[model samples]
Target chain A: MPAQTIVPVEANLINALEDRGLRKTSARSAVTTRIETASGAFTAEQLCRDLPEVGRATVYRTIRHLVDAGALCKLPMLDGAPKYSVARNEHHHHTICSRCGAVEEFRHSTVERVMRSLEKEIDGDIVGHRMEIFITCSNCLAESNRGGSSGR
Target chain B: MPAQTIVPVEANLINALEDRGLRKTSARSAVTTRIETASGAFTAEQLCRDLPEVGRATVYRTIRHLVDAGALCKLPMLDGAPKYSVARNEHHHHTICSRCGAVEEFRHSTVERVMRSLEKEIDGDIVGHRMEIFITCSNCLAESNRGGSSGR
Candidate 1:
């Protein structure tokens, strides 16, 4: 797949921090850069490993800041470990490969409409949503077929 | 809210175990019973805390067994700790309160229809799907209103 153009959301993230009266620290800037340049979802541990100079506490704090600012979205893995991705301004959902752990983003107007209708039905102000569909990717399916019943 | 009618799916759980040629151990029976009687989602730690008689290892193993057998569905909590609930035969989704930690289950045929359509669009078999909406519960909203700007 071609590289997804990173829509430089770092400026927006920095402004959000400033709005909350937070100082623009170097650690926060580094974390935002990493999040922006990331190809896909990443974990805090991965961030720490990749940026050894950034202390674990700083990484976590920056992550919390970004998440609170709505600049990052958390995607929960099957094993309960959450992966963080850039929170695009536009709403979308994820389709994850159960076997290969690849995530693809998609949006549907119908789902959005249904969610709006559900807010009235449930009598609560819907703040956020998470939707993920798990499937075996085509490559994994092909390999399983080739291996017959022995393949999982 | 009125208590949700506990559908007795324990029998199906046991049958699933039997189908896998697993023995009907007392530990499994206890875990199944606890799950059947649960009012909502529970974590493995909670289960171990509630059922001290069941060893921690036994609790984890039984949870894995039930999950593999499709007798339980693991819901990912916002904090990354997963909570397991009895997996009913039919499909459903949950709406969770971000403030008070309340969970509400709901089903919509429109959502189901869209999922089926998505499978064709993606050109992949949809094995499973998860949908969760995060909102502030009515009581929390009321409390926030009563406390004015001081309320979180």
Candidate 2:
């Protein structure tokens, strides 16, 4: 497996607050930290649950600010509400693990080429595109192969 | 340009209700007719507005039932709530017009080929995927080219 290059969107919460012209507050600081260090995509409700010390309103506001600041990426799910993840500066797509809820970023030249090629055929001026793939991650696949049905 | 083919998910509301074992209420009939004849994607609120005689609760419940019955397709937007379109039996992707808010369905084999190819490289068992392209539709593009900046 290739090494996953996880890049931090913001080095610290303070710089992000300054960039967005948002006031520095303890509640915002805690929420920013939690978001930056999140291992996978999460919902605002999950963040509220994780940070009982911070007011729910504060957490939601900080999340909105970060999203507007382009520090977080919001993914649209097929069934329920959207999820947010720490944003990466580079262009890429997401692969979500159905079993363990892991999100991985990937980019392939062929996929991009196909997207760009659509410009000539499609009846529109293509401004942007989003693609999300749902999968059972390799870890889960391996576990299933080994007769482990716990996660299922 | 190739002609777009849209096959209906259910021939009629009565059949759809029958398949789901849902009682064919008058309110459900009204909502189902409105949905089946809709020209584009719409929200539950839009349906409620269109069907002023039907109760809001009935419209919402009917939409949920149709979605579950595979009669409507729910599309997730980037920054706002998701919208629903009449379901087409065939597999396809959506191209949304940013200027006019029109949603068009299309299918490209090369795009599907690229998606399937990802399974060999990615660390996951591919289950499903979604792709939504944002564009200025041909009509919008033509209007823009004609020095009509009204939509802008």
Candidate 3:
């Protein structure tokens, strides 16, 4: 099983700030703390609301900073606002459970191989890619199999 | 090779408008013409700028309506505004050339098979997914092979 664990987002923030030759102020710390403990995908608006002490500009800037630093990932939704999540792995994709809002990190060799083969067919150099698989998670599947009602 | 072609955006708009019990107004027709003639991908702001006679609200609303109707697809960019493109095919993913901004629609069985297998591993039912591959198009590859500079 590929390791499915959250990265040390605070450490990533500190490292990113250091790389940019910046200091970690109290506001940054507060935002990092909130993000570290976030349950699943969140939004900048939610962060701004939760971190009232931090300036809205600071919140947005900090999120953008971390995202640029590869510390955060955005989950693109088809019909709604995009959501943000901590980068779980250096080279992994997401399997998001639509039913329970659970996001799982996964890495598979088969997928990577398929991506590499595109170089030949497209006759181009493959630079980067993004994939998001939406599903009903395992737990949700089990619950539905048992015909139990979910609070969600 | 799978069919790599643009969908009939105007027909799609007409059908969508009909489904909503709406008529094909001149404004809608103008927007459709612009979209149909768009090279690869476009933005709402660009469309609004090009069609000054169309209300900004109408431009935004029509784009949303057609997007919901599966006439247009949004190319989610990593560092900039998401670009809009005509949906080229049904049940196909995109390969965007970073060099020339060319978008190619492709459907590969291996990719689909891998996605389906996720059902067993994730213990969930797969609902939907989106994949966008960034690459250099075949033409760009040839140009680069000849050591020629691209205008882009």
Candidate fnat values, all: 0.78, 0.97, 0.84
lDDT by residue (tens digit), candidate 2, B39-145: 88998888899999999998888888887887777888876767888767467888999888788888899988998789898987899888888898998988888
lDDT of 3 by residue, A5-92 (tens): 6545456656666577667888887887788877877878899999889999998999888887878887766545567888877888
Q: Give one digit per residue, the lDDT tens place, for model 1 in A36-84.
A: 7767778889999988889999999888888888777778787846888
lDDT of 1 by residue, B1-152 (tens): 55576545447776677678899989888887787777777889999988999999999998898888877888888684687877664678887888877777778887888887787677466788899989888878988889976655
Q: Which candidate is the best by DockQ?
A: 2
Instruction: State the fnat of model 3.
Output: 0.84
Write the number of the candidate with greater DockQ, choosing between 2 and 3: 2
Candidates sorted by TM-score, descending order? 2, 3, 1
Return the TM-score for each candidate structure: 0.78, 0.84, 0.81
User: What TM-score does candidate 3 reach?
Assistant: 0.81
Clashing pairs in 2: none
lDDT at B14, model 1: 69
Candidate 3: lDDT of B52? 97
Ranking by lDDT: 2, 1, 3
- Interface RMSD of predicted model 3: 2.0
Question: What TM-score does chain B alone reach in each candidate, compared with the true chain B?
Answer: 0.74, 0.85, 0.81
**Higher-DockQ candidate of 1 and 3:** 1
